[model samples]
Target: MPPIVLTIPEAVTASKMSRTAIYNALKDGTLCARKSGRRTLIPTGELQRYIDALPPYTGKV
Candidate 1:
């Protein structure tokens, strides 16, 4: 089974987003994260929700 939580780097890889983008999202409340000790973890479902909430592609650009 896939992991339920992903670290910052793992989230970047799985979402194909830059580390800065992920951090920005977290900072801006666009994405949610959890704390495990000193590590920040993103839930797979939360990431999926964030992606789903994005506007659909219109193929205009």
Candidate 2:
């Protein structure tokens, strides 16, 4: 199967998080992305793992 990779915009949308947030996550070791020429791509598998590791959502007042 083709490796599932997402561009910055696509990843931002997928994660519902800002590009800066994504970059910060990468810098802090919470996220990992690959740099190809002028583009940064995030592997879908890694993205999924990150999501799965997130704390559960809690509705709050």
Show model 2 residue runs off by greater than 4 Å: 1-3
lDDT for position 15 in model 2: 81
Query: Per-residue lDDT tens digits of candidate 2, residues 1-61?
Result: 7559999899888889888988888898888889999998999998888878888879875
Tens digit per residue, CA lDDT, model 1, 1-61: 9899999999999999999999999999999999999999999999999989989999997
What candidate 1 gets wrong by more than 4 Å, as runs, is none
TM-score of each: 0.91, 0.78
**lDDT score at residue 45, model 1, on the 0-100 scale:** 99
C-alpha root-mean-square deviation, candidate 1: 1.0
RMSD to true structure for each model, in Å: 1.0, 2.1
Error of 1 at 54 (Å): 0.9
Clashing pairs in 1: none
